[model samples]
Target chain A: MDGVMNPTTNIISFDLTTTSLRDVNHYLHHQVSPGNHIDIHHPNGAHNLAVGLQEAIAVDIHGHTGYYAAGMNQLASVTIHGNAGAGVAENMMSGRVHVKGFASVSAGASAQGGLLVIDGDAGLRCGISLKGGDIVVGGSVGSFSAFMAQAGHMVICGDAGDALGDSLYEAVLYVRGNIKSLGADAQIEPMTEDDQAIVANLLEQAGFSHNPNDFQRVASARQLYHWNADAKQDY
Target chain B: MCGIVGLLIKNPALRDSLGALTVPMLIGMAERGPDSAGLAVFTQPIAESDRKYSLYSGTTVVDWGQLIQALHQQLGGTAQIHTQGNHGILTANLSPAVVKPWIHEHYPAVHILSTGRTIDLYKDEGQPAAVAERYGFSQLKGTHVVAHTRMATESAVTPAHAHPFTAGEDFCLVHNGSLSNPHSIRRMLEPRGIHFDTDNDTEAACRYLEWRMQEGDDLKSALQKGFEELDGFFTFLMGTQDTLALVRDAFACKPAIVAETDDYVAIASEFRSLAHLPDIDHATLYEPAPEEMYVWTVS
Candidate 1:
């Protein structure tokens, strides 16, 4: 049995296939310091695996993870090799987190910073109230995604959920797949050359295999900010 | 998670005295982050000499009693050190770098989280109000401040995992969402030498903005780039020393409402939170669009 130690600049591996994840996290909580590298192998559907870590550490989850996998993260690199449960990476501040598989509901809800990448499908309310940061989803997103979003950009490679970009302010939505419908005050605009270039650059950065030219763009009408009491009569 | 309240005011006296607002705000959001709470208010930028001394030996970590004694001895009796649970806030002639390293060395078990020019972090394990009272947030004062309450569903419930995280020297972020692909993004940014702390996705969002800002992009442009680059559902709010920015995902799954008038602009996760504000004349409140951002600055 490896005894726990103080925060050190070392590379540690937390393999859950053989041992429990709680023990690993507990052991690492005291021993792992900022600027350390921690690799978690065979997570195997663990819940709330990596919650609050303040150290500048690196964590790689090898297998699928349960709910709230990486919530309230500060400065750390957490990578999930498989799908994530609801509220994955919730309320993250600084650091980078990556998910290679599908994501459940409320993904990146009210996220302040960092870059969140989902290579697979995303569930509901993705990027809701997103103040800042970037979210790149390679697959389709479920319903009510980005509802009442104040800021940030959401890129969808597959179909989008209902009420997409509803009540949005200045964020940009780019979708490569078929959009079921546009949400309130959300309009589909022509992808200009610049828009296409942006999509291409994002695709390249996300390592997406798809062609950027196929994607479309959606944005807020900016009319909601100036609500015309008379305009309501038209509706 | 935890709670944080900070204010920036034009009047130093008012700024220092206006800390009372933090008490209620922290109490209101107590359930959101049931950890510790802290408050900080700065009248102006710290002096260079004070900043220099605060950078090195002055800000060493110590217990509440010891910290108070040291503050009194080193910076005279003007320093204020407030502690609650495992978290606390110290306001004196000190720099963030100095305070952060001291916290790390002495309170290694407690998450130092972040330190900024005008912002100080303190958190433990309880409701926001409890934490606030424990840290003497009721006495804080500033023109503007931000706080958070945590519900630890997505991440671990530790003092370190709190909100109102610092993105840069003058920027702080609060969120209510999750990042879908944090690993790949982490891999992408690691080579760039950006350091990260927690495993949560919010940090990734902060790093992304820092990266964009470092590349000479303004807040708006950097946020736009963030929309196209990052993945997953999210609703976020960011505050700089001078500006406040809000963003929602393309799908717009979560809920965020904005209320604005000629005098002030108010935003909250639920509309009820804003209904009690005083003198909200000619207010127009509505939900933000998906994949959109709303920015407010001092006019």
Candidate 2:
């Protein structure tokens, strides 16, 4: 009925110790506006914080969060000042999510777009099946990372655990340190000029100072897409 | 999943509010594990030359006065019992070993939560808030406190199934993960005359630590042995007479955080559990690496 609403500059705060998780999520779903800032205190390991948001609002969680915090987001950016539990930012579609401390299992699982950054190490299965988003970890990542990732980019400044990439697809992965093992249909790929540019840009965006040249790229071998009678032994 | 909270106050000035401060921490973790809750408060050692034994009765009603009188007549010593909710702490002028075996023989329905000079343990199958209120957690005065909220993964939801499992005299442990080889370990310990009350895996780990310490191993070495001998994921918070220790499995599948300030050293399964702590903003917070054992002691 009218021109677009002016970008909101209001800051709203929710104290989790006094407010219910349902009320917080309902407020984020209905009251959030573009450019609005939300601060959540005493998150106290509550689950599903700031989930399913599409606005370009910013959420700053002051304490640790439980599973699926900021899961399946669109344009909203979320920052956890403390550690995150399992499935954080799972199936996220767009915008940015940053974890200042460590993350439990499946830190950035199946995100399709935007950047997911962890300042500390991420537990097992990080960035699993990430569709198109970029993930950058300032520290090491646990085993089975980037498993079945279809698209996007991942940069680890520290070591990667066992099976760095398992059955991954078009997504490009770069790690500065050693990988314990590789999953089926995943292998190391030579870094080209374009790969360096992509990793450098992602690292810069994620606020990491790691040099792009130190990273090794990995991708899917593309060998298991179809069944072969002669390759039955491999199966 | 489970929630663990422990606070070891370095400053004696904060001793009086230890229980008040820890009640909120344990209650704050209600969402993590709501099936049951427990707390072990290590109070300042009393001046009296008596032994204190914390006991629990799962039944809704019990005659605590009669039980205490009977215990006094049998053990031939003066006894005083304090009852809170479903638990009681009995102080008697008798050796703990003499009183413990007598309780086990005469009062099989009564569960011995802890027996120590400074620790009083309370636990039951209920919400965290209810359990804390039942045990007067907010009013307890202690030098340190360790608590747990159990979600009932490996054992049935009962008063005896709660955590803060006693490791040895004046030592206890709370665990957050399942043990893969508890049966084998229990078999090994049973032959060594170690008794168990429940089949819960954590009790096995607790008894194992007790056995190791009995064999003259220090707490640090015994926890290191836990990493070598125990399999599966775990993050353990252990409390002794004067120190608190935390250790994680090699894979560290569980989550844990440590925060320390000038007044106290605190550990919790999550940072949220420490948010309400005093001066937490100024506290140094970090996650311990896998297989790394961190200990804090108060003099």
Candidate 3:
């Protein structure tokens, strides 16, 4: 891929077919100031694209990415025009990672901060071990989503697979469609006005036209917060 | 971590390029599985009376033509050998009951990989690319292919332990995850007089599913029974003479992606392994859901 800078528009375009991933990642890490627009072409399911970005820039990828694309982002907004593999926006301190197509497993795992938006379905463990981040999926999320989540909010515009929000802590989940089954210590509570407002805001950010009122809240029952010997591990 | 790839050409004319397309998919998974590799191809069936046995010489060289001559002289039926590197496929009109023991008694070093009417399998302890080249995989023509690149999470990295494990006629299975209860499954099957070729956990799973099929269960029913019996993580891809099937375990920790077009249905452990497929940009791509059966057949 030809890695070149356009003098007129102030855009840096890197073609993966001609440019090595290391070179493009090197430029993304060491070069470019804030507000720069980067275009990556022909990703072809390559892994670890646009990771560790610490500036307020815009990066757009044109094709499918393998794994861990846009991981550990600080302030950059990255958009993948095609499907993304596992861990699309993991451990982001802050930023926006948008997938135009489906996302594989662990869409936003253990993120301290960021808004991860997926326009299509997400694979298993969508938000497993989440910590202080917001995830909005336009399509369904697979099983074991939000397992042991510590903080942040998740909004699902579609159905959820088995075991949604197992061992959740503080983090709230809003689903607009059916949840096949709930995990241990995870219950569906009534959606309040404040929760609706948060879902509305997250939906707007995610560019989805779904109504926030259709969502239901899923959170921790807090039963497993303390051990009781008589429970015998039954939920 | 291992990688499993399967391709079933929907168009009859594209079957010749089966191995040509599958080689890239296997090589793309090099990082996930580097220690060993195997491929099983379901070619056109010869006839009901004939059986094709895939034999490996295992780090040793032998006169393949002489082996076939010896089989003809001893068994006195139609026998032929197709030699490729250290592997030979012996097609005989005689039953395995007459052929297997004779080969064991005469050619003790030759190990059989699979026995079927339409299957020929090759496996070795080497890099995936090297194994593919060593077996001339690019020239293989078949209705479907089930291949594996193993990371050796269990069992030794030997030719026997390489995946695409076969159990019965025209059937093979490749796995990409570990089985927690393989010993239990083995013990369960062993009392039934089922013999195991390797201690590899995938072998147990392969044998279990094939055993279920042998016990009057259809492929889908056998797979459903497998879901109830096989524990731990897995993303299995299997191939029969005319079918290719894929299934992931509950929890679905191991990744799997399927790209289906009018021409082909490609299954891989990851999307990158399928990126180079024809018309892939426009193919319908989706991850196989957990505990779900996806089966495709040749038309």
The per-model DockQ list reads 0.06, 0.43, 0.84
Model 2, residue B202: distance off in Å is 1.7
Model 1 Cα lDDT, one tens digit per residue, A1-235 = 3432236645567667576767877755666777777777756456678876667888878766766887777788788987776778888786767889777778887777766788888877888777675688988887777777777677899999788888887778888878887888888988899887777776776788777678888988877888587775753
Candidate 2, A1-235: lDDT as tens digits: 1112334645677888688889889888887789988888888778899899889999999888888999998999999998888889999999999999888889889999988999999888899989998899999998889999999999998999888888888888999998988888989989999999999999899998888999999999899888767886943
Question: What TM-score fits each model?
Answer: 0.49, 0.87, 0.98
Question: Model 3, range B1-299, lDDT digits (tens) per residue?
Answer: 99999999898899999999999999999888999999999988889999999999987898999998888997899898988878999999989888888988999999989999989999998999999999999999988999999998878889899989999788899998999999999999999989998899999999999999999999999999999999999999999988999999988879899999999999999888998898999999999988999999888
lDDT of 1 by residue, B1-299 (tens): 32222223333444454456345545644544565433333334444434211111213344666765755675453455555444555555665555556656655544544445455544445777666665676666544555566666567765556665555565667666777876777788889877777777777887788778888999999999989887886777776656667888885655565556554555655432343444432456455667777777643
- Candidate 3 stretches with Cα past 4 Å from truth are A233-235
Give, for candidate 1 chain B, the lowest lDDT window spanning 10 residues: B51-60
lDDT of 2 by residue, B1-299 (tens): 99889999998999999999999889878887899999998876754578788988788466889888888888888889998756889988888778888887988878889977888998888999998887788998888888999998888887788898995578899989899999999999999889998999999899998899999999988887888888887888888878888888876778787889999998888766787788887888777767888988877
**RMSD over all Cα atoms, model 3:** 1.4
Interface C-alpha root-mean-square deviation of candidate 1: 12.9
Ranking by DockQ: 3, 2, 1
Real contacts retained, model 3: 0.82
Report residue A209 deviation for candidate 2 (angstroms). 3.9
Chain B alone, model 2: TM-score?
0.96
lDDT of 1 at B15: 49
Give the Å shift of residue B118 in candidate 1: 2.1
Best by DockQ: 3
